[model samples]
Target: MSQSLDRALTLLGSLGDGPVSLGQAAASIGVHKSTALRLLRTLEEHGFVHRLSDRRYRLGGRVLSLAQRALQGIDVRQVAAPYLAALHERFGCTVQLAVLEDDEVLYLDELTGRWSTGAGLPDRIGRRAPAAGTAIGRVLLAGLPQDGRAEEELPAELAAVRRRGWAAESSGHLETVTSVAAPVAGSDRRAVAACAVSAPADRVSPAELVRLVPELLCTAEAISLAYGGSPTPRWCENRCGARPVVRASRT
Candidate 1:
């Protein structure tokens, strides 16, 4: 593997246990402290890693987002594209693929409604969102590992999503947008990402959002299976889908 890829996996493996000091991380990864710091810094810039107030490092919010996009740009999205487009056409709304990084939700890819201003929003392929208010955020938050102190409220609805299989939001994150999301798992049987749909609150209801759960779950699972993830994840899953599509392929 390339040096960067090797370092990233090392960082990820180290983070699976809990937050650690830079020194510990360097030692665990068998790299010089300076080299580890440089790698961490690079990962931080891409949203794949985070640095705590104490200078400890953790996973960042962009990791999931980028991973999902990477998967979509590969084979899973290509396979799911028709399904995603069909869903968008049926609902005339926006469909989003989201993944967890740190304590946030990151957009992987989206299919927007004809009348939607989704393109105007900052939710490009790698845009990040607070994993609190939005339905996608709730879905991701619900799937996050309980390894470290979250430092955020774990709402009942979000908790319910973990118990159940989905979550919804009604004009919570945005002023008038309603959303529904479902968890996606990784090979470790953990929730790593989610798939969601969003529409104008005026045009969608809580019941309707709940009804969309199965479809979102299907999409998420398809992506997860593509990534060789398990049928069930312990926390969250990575929906890379089975195929690896690079951004260059999209371009």
Candidate 2:
């Protein structure tokens, strides 16, 4: 790589130790303090670094925004498409794939199942819902680390979801609807999205929906693995033990 590019990347990596002063960065990277300041200024102009009031430099919001956009383009929905269709075929319940976006569950894809009510559960693709209320939300939230928000700010149902490793809701977002969801994790074992099945409450009563937990969990694992998620002990027992196996991404 060019010297400037190499130096910039070296400086970026150095900031991982937290904010650094020009002298500290120069000494660490084997560059003069003046050269380090010039590089830092270039990075600041691009919003890749921020100079603090104390004259230390740290990462900037632009870097965070870029990382978020990269995560959003991970193609989990594409990776899970066939599995979702198979899940829909098995139970004939609406199958949905969603990701948590700014405290809301943003529906990325949906497959209408055979048992769809055709009334209560509308086509949810391109739609969003509060993350504290829906089954998918609970599953996604359960996978996240606890942030010390007030208990009242979070729904009590999340506790049950964490304990059960899954979540289900009756009349969720729509009257007479029942929805069950499981987390779809990434390579880091962090839930990047959720897989959910929705049907009319009368047709797929909560008790009957409970019976589908195994299948839902299995499908989620299959999708998670396809997306490069590290396999858990349960997943190791029989990795992706589901039908219509999804092909893992080569990338």
Candidate 3:
């Protein structure tokens, strides 16, 4: 069973190049076509592979979902590094840029303390943070699509964060850690990523963190706009100054 599972994983990894037919998958796995078909069926049932109408198979929406989340998270890291670096230098605390992934917040990049020498925080490039508790999670939860068909569990607090345009947690997810976060929006005014600061709750009062909200919002908006996406629903609706918001609604 273990050997078969390993072989199946190997076969699935090959699909990254492009779609393949049943015979191709079988050949790649060194198995009979019948055996490949059975393996594909099992993988399809688990949302790993999707069969097209023409009988060729490709990575499924489940896979694409993971990929999209990774892209958004990485994009934020790319776009927000300078701002985060300056912010960390000013605030003298660790900063993180993260995005939602499967009901969790994944850190894409982080800037650590001067005294700490960037060695304490885990290498969280692809790690997941609990979506229910972190400030970034709250902002992302708030900005996600609210329809019943939404892919993730969008709780009410996250929804409220969306309406309010920012989120914060005081020792909510981690003991002694307080974070203030803001959403990064796409052209739809929907959030595509999040930016946050993590510090000792006692050192940074809620009022001080609240004061940072506008700056964080500006940073997020700048990144979103730099990516050619709308910064907010109000921006999309023409409530703020800029070129009239291009409607991101899929016609």
Candidate 4:
């Protein structure tokens, strides 16, 4: 790699801990003071670094903007499509992908399963639903930080979902329909979206739905991995507080 490119990347990596002085940055990257100053000036010109009042430099707004643009380019629906299809094939239930948008659950994709009753399912892409009333919404809401939301401010259902690391609803939002969901986490180990399966209440009893949790979790993990997120067996223990007695063997 070119010396400038290498130094720039190293500088970017070093800033992860916080701002750095020019001398400190140069010493850390093994570059001369003059060379480092020139590089910092270049980075500042491009909005990649900000020179602080104290003479230290920190990451700039453009870094965050670039990160956001990169994330926007990653189509979660595209990444999760095969997993959703596999889940549908396994359970023969309507599979849905959703993300929190505008404080609501926005359906990104849907695949009708053979046995799905299809009642109350958000069949179309871009369908919106109240986050408090749907399985996917509950999982997404549960994954959000609770500090700003007072205990009373949070819905009881969402609190329960957070405790359980999963959510299920019977005849909720739509009569005679059942849905279960889990988080599709990103690299931050937070829900960027959710994966859910819906079926007729009669076709999928609560007990059967519980049995499907392992598959649901595995599918979610697969999607998370596809999105460059870390996936570990500990997800069940950390998020659900319960480990699957019967782990789903990778196929």
Runs of candidate 4 exceeding 4 Å displacement? 1-74, 116-122, 147-155, 231-251
Top model number, TM-score: 2
Determine which window of 10 residues in candidate 1 has minimal summed lDDT. 242-251
Report lDDT per candidate.
0.69, 0.80, 0.72, 0.78
At residue 117, candidate 4 shows an lDDT of 46
Per-residue lDDT of 1-251 in model 4, one digit per residue for the tens? 99899999899878866899999999979989999999999999999999999999999989878865754555887788888887787678788888897679877788986664445443546467899888889899888877777655777877778666789887665877777899987766778899987777777786677678777887887777766665454344554443334332222
- Per-residue CA lDDT of candidate 1, range 105-220, in tens? 76767887554654333344656777886777777777777676453555667668777778777765486777788766666767766778887666667678767666666666
- CA RMSD of all predictions: 12.5, 13.2, 11.3, 15.2
- In angstroms, how far off is 143's CA in candidate 1? 1.2
Return the top candidate by lDDT: 2
The candidate with the higher TM-score, 2 or 4, is: 2
lDDT of 3: 0.72
**Candidate 2, 170: how far from true, in Å?**
1.4
- Model 2 spans with C-alpha error above 4 angstroms: 1-74, 147-156, 233-247
Candidate 3 has what TM-score?
Answer: 0.60
